[model samples]
Target: MTITPQNADDSCLINQTVPTGVMSPPSEYLDEKKQLPNQNQNQNQNSTSHSGEDQESQKGRSRSIEDATAPLPSSSSSDRGDDNDNNDDDDDFPEGGLAAWLVVFGSFCSMVCLYGLINSVAVFESYFSTHQLAGYSSSTIGWVFSVYLFIVFFFGVQVGPIFDRHGPRLLVAVGSLLVVASQLILGLCEEYYQILLTYAVLGGIGGALLNVPAYGVIAHFFKRRRGMAVGVAATAGSVGGIVFPLFLQAVIPKLGFAWSTRIIGFILLFLSVIANLLVRSRLPPSTHPVRILPDWTLFKDLKFTLCCVGVWFMEWGIFTPLTYIVSYAAAHGQDANAAYTLLSILNAGSFFGRFLPGFLADRFGRFNVITITNALCVVTILAFWLPAGDSRALLIVFAVTFGFASGSNLGLYPVCIGQLCDARDYGRVYSTAVMIGSFGTLTALPIAGALLEIGSDERQGWLALILFAALSYAIATSCFLGARVLAVSWRVKEVY
Candidate 1:
């Protein structure tokens, strides 16, 4: 007999026919008593029971087969629902697209304006100490930049939560205005306090506003590719680092400090416009009002605590070289032009170093790559920088190598922090980490400058400072290793 199965959708046709031979006896009918010879009776009863059991088992199997092959209304619908839910979750992350990359580009421009000015601090420091603040000791002059650096990170504590609530638009816009204003007004300042208020206080606040959001917004757009995205954005700072110094070197001789700064202000104005247009947040703002305060409770996480400590020491080591490299080169008898050129070279190397480690961190692990680079920084400080007294080539080599190694610290530290917390809390966590590290930045230059005064000879003073930097990196490396070990076991092959 031929039979046609019903489709699941055709539920209206409820009645169906079965072939005549397909029906089975009821259990009671099959079990009814039978008479026979004693031995034959036993065998016949066993065969009857076995036949009934076989038919029952076959029927159960056929039902299971039909259930497996045919789709049920509720189950099939629910399955589709689950798939849709998963798709919705995935759709929340754009991952990679034109809009996403535009955010990245906008971040890049913002960083160029923010960090570019930051990276060029050495130029300002060098120029100011010699010209405007010539009467002050190097240690005293260090306070201006130190204060600037301190406020930049310290303000992040408050700015981070604000970014989470309002998004990056207003923060970046205000930052752009403040930074441009700082530069434009900076050219007109002559007194120490005027310079301090204009450059240190104003610029620092602007930078804090710009810096946190530039790094934080990228977290909104990318996850797996975050390191690469951050790296690309960070390279803009190094480019600014290279360009700003060269720009100053070229124009300062002809236009003097005032007009040179104004030209830079104009350049920053243009960059800020691009940043305002493109930099945007992908995630929605928090519904509940968040306190614009640092969550000190984050210290509860040992990894975060350790990461903060590691960053503290790393920041202590990093800025000492950046702030003092030009001064150190000049003190060691290098020509004025060459001494300033060393800063450019360091930033030039940093241009590549910023992105390369970022790219590598995505493939390897963030902590792993940062730890290696931090170790290299220690080696460069002690091995190359310390012994290179008056050696132009060694100073150049140290600048380049140290720049390459230390550049990762800026780009990778945020990525490392992101690894510890949710993306939504990244701004708060990262800003807190930076706030902690700000103390290091605040004290490192002044302390290094004081150490410079301690030595009777300039060489001895520099040696003390270099050793201080080296020791800081050593501590940073240890903390990073501890954090890594806590995150993943000692197994070297683990991808963590």
Candidate 2:
């Protein structure tokens, strides 16, 4: 029977056939006239008319049933056309513009609030576990901060897709509200579970929501410059890390944790507002009804997969030092006041760590910068931190140097992953890494706590932490090298 398939495009069809049809020569008689453009059009129409008869003749004569059940001409043609249309759509994007850069700046500010405080949580944890919450076990108190961090990255599986579907305005707005609430309630959290539920889980969710949008919005506006833009934006988190610790150090003693945390929350609220105003996707929401779920298929990308593994190891051990350094100092030998100052010094080094290496990554390669810096971190822990006695000068050197190296690790991971995937898939890739890294944060501190317990002394615990940092960095270095091998082969001289 004759069939006319769906015609979705306005262009004249170039080819056609019936489902059962055998291939045929042009029906127009072979003549000089056939070469004319006008004759070609006439031949196309005549071929359409003969389609059914051609199908029947071919079906009965052909030996293969597969030939008889072949696809229809219009269906095949339309499929090709549709594929082209999708490609065209995928190719369309705004790589960079004034408004897009502004959005990047806005994203930077949002990250400062969401991730900045998070980076400084060690300072908070060290101080609180010793002072106000000194009654709580280190492991128990750790749970409070772990849950906070866990939520920040864990819930992005849903939040990311939601941002893709609805844009950042409402998502960021809600995050702002939740984050502010977290800070307000945090002031009242005297019990362990209250802190866990309020700061760890609730604040984490808020930060997670804020984070995906913070990075995802920039992806919408850039492709070629995505690395630089995201690196610059991400540096704000470190800036926040730097600023908040110093800010808190000054205020917490004077104003107290409740008022200090509230002030930081207010700062976050202001940044989130700016983020809501600026962060935007250039394209409309995708028409396909799909949930934004973390696809493990990302592992198929060898470089990306290795990078994720490296990040996991880096995060797991990175926090051990971050959370324990102040406490370690205070408990072991240094004055409490001096110990707190160490956090500020670490963050100060981190400020340049996050920014300068990012600029360097653009010139070198993301993996190259990450591996070298991470290796430096491993060495510093082994060489400097291990032998650090009550010599305040040595500890200061270790903190600043390790802080700088660790800063490079933070700034480069996302940029490296962004290199691996299409701009649109960045949120999924980023969140997946964050999701996996969350577990690292959840366990690193507790493990240090347990090690401290093993020795019945804070000094032994500090030794375990130094060991953890050294080993974790060693693992990270391996993973990064593995990724480097995959990307540029064994060419050790390659910049990537």
TM-score of each: 0.82, 0.79
In Å, residue 109's CA in model 2 sits off its true spot by 1.4
Per-residue CA lDDT of model 2 for 135-161, tens digit only, reads 988887777777777777778767766
Supply candidate 1's per-residue lDDT for 42.
54
lDDT of 1 at 339: 78
**Top model by TM-score, which number?**
1
Error (Å) of candidate 1 at residue 437 is 1.2
Tens-place lDDT per residue, model 1, 1-496, is 3212111111111111234464443433221221122334455456545654444322101223224324312212222121111111122346678998899999999898878888888899989988999999988888998899899898998888888788999999999999999999999999899999999999999999998899998988876567788998899889998999888988898899999999999999999999999998866564324666767777876767888899989988998999888888888787667777888899999988999999877666677889999999999998999999889999989989998998888999998887665465667778888999989889888998899888577778888999999999999999988877765547464343
Who wins the lDDT comparison?
Answer: 1
Full-model lDDT for every candidate:
0.78, 0.69
Q: Give RMSD to native, each candidate.
A: 18.2, 13.2
Give me the runs in candidate 2 sitting further than 4 Å from their true place: 1-96, 284-289
